[model samples]
Target: MNRTARLYALVEELRAAAPRPVTVAALAARFEVSTRTVQRDLQALMAARIPVRAVPGRGGGWSIDPGMTLPPIHLTAGEASALTTALAAVDAATPYADAARSAAQKIEAAMAGPAAAAARELARRIVTLPRPGDSAIRTAVERALAEGTVLLLSYRDAAGHESDRAVEPAGLLAADGRWYLIAWCRTRRAGRGFRLDRITAAAPTGERAQPHDLAELLSGSAAAGAVRPTALGPLPVAIA
Candidate 1:
C-alpha cells in the first residue's frame, strides 16, 4: 500500500485492536514494511492528532484511542450522487431522518461546484414514497436511540389497546414503508417492536439504556425476515 493508504489501514488496524497494543514487528509484517517505516507512519498519524499512542513495554507497541474518529475520505462526483440517491430513497420516518438529510447536504458541500450541481440534479430525479408517521415522533425516537437512554412511549397496539411503555432503545427497524423501534420494552419485560405510527407520544427517559443482543432479540420474531444484517451493523434496513 502507498503511504496514504497504509496510514489509513494502520489506523484501522490499531482501532480494531484498541486498548490492546500491537507490536511494531507485527504491524510491519502485516503491512509488509520495515519497522522503521511503521514507526515513521505512527509519528505522522500522531502529528495529525489522530489520538494514537505508544505503549512502552515488552508486549507493547502502538494503539489508537477508542473514542477517536477519522475524517471521511474524499468522494468522486458519482460517489457523491450515489450517496444523495441513497438518502433520498430512505423513508422519511426512519430514525435519524434529519441527520441522513444533513449527511447528503454535507456530501454535496464537499464536492466541487459542477460536481455538486450534477449530484443535485441526479438526486432530484429520484423519489421515495412517504411513510405514515409524525416527524416529531421520529425525532423523539432518534433522540432516545442516539443518547442510549430509555424511551417513554404511549403506544397503541393493533388491538386498539393503548398503554404507556418504558423501552430501551436498541435499534430501528424499517419495514413495508413504516418504521419500528426495535427496543427492549421494560413494561412488557421482553423485546418488542413498536410501530412508529402506533406511538402516540415519545420522549427520552434520561436513564441509561441497557444493551441487548439484537440478533437474540429478533430471533424467531416475525420481523426477522424484514431486516437483513448489513456491514453497517444492526441498524435495520428494509429488505429489498
Candidate 2:
C-alpha cells in the first residue's frame, strides 16, 4: 500500500481500538514511519470531521470521541454487490423516501476510481419492487419507535369501519409485500398487527410505553400464521 493508504489504515486501526487512546509513537512504529507522518494522518482525520483528541505528556496519546459517526467503508466488488442486495431488500420492504439516496451517496463517498464508478453503475442498473405504504403512517411509526410514544390511530378495520384506537407501538414488521405495526392495544388489552396503509390518522400520545422484549415479540411463534396473541406481556398502563 502507498503511504497515504497505509496511514489511513492506521487511523482505522486506532479508531477501532478506542476508547483506548493510541500514541503517535506506537502508530509510527507499527507503520515504520516517523511521528510526523502519523501526526499528519491525524490532521487529515480531524479535517474530515472525525472527533480525534490528542493528549499531551508521557503515556498520553490520541482518542476518538465516542458517538462520532465513522465514514462509510470502501467496498470491493464482492462487498459492493452484497451491500446493494441488502439495501435493495430494505428499500423494497420499507420504501423510505430518503434511505436509498442516502445509502448511494455514502457508498460513492467511501469508494474511489473505477470501483466507485462500478458500484454506482451497478446500483443504477438494480431495481427493487416496493410494497404500498402511506409515507405518513411510516413516518409516524418511525417517530413513535424513536420517541417510545404510544400512538392514537384512526384505522379502517376489515369490515371497513373507521374508528380511533390507542396502541403501544412495539415495533414494525414487513411481510408478504405489506408493512404491519406490531403493537399493544389499550382497548383490547392484547397485541395486534395493524396494516400501515389502512391507518388513516396517527398521533403520538407523548407518553412512552414500557420496554418490550423485541426478540421474543418477533420470534417464530409470532410468525405470520401464528395465533399467539400475548407475546411479551401486558402493555403498561399510561403514566399519569
Model 1 pairs whose backbones collide: none
- lDDT value, candidate 2, whole model: 0.71
Q: For model 2, how does the per-residue alpha-carbon lDDT over 1-240 read when each residue is reduced to its tens digit?
A: 565477457657777878888898888888888999889888977765557879778778998765665544555776865565456456533735445645655455556777767766776777766656566777777788878889999999889998888988877776666777888888887677788878898888789886665545555545645343453468778998
Q: How many backbone clashes does candidate 1 have?
A: 0
Residue-level lDDT tens digits of model 1 in 18-73: 88999999999999999999999999888766789999978888988878665457
The lDDT for every candidate, in the order shown, is 0.82, 0.71
Looking at model 2, residue 73 earns an lDDT score of: 59
Q: How close is every model to the real structure, measured as TM-score?
A: 0.63, 0.58
Score residue 115 of candidate 1 by CA lDDT: 82
**Could you tell me the TM-score of candidate 2?**
0.58
Q: Give the Å shift of residue 171 in candidate 2.
A: 1.6
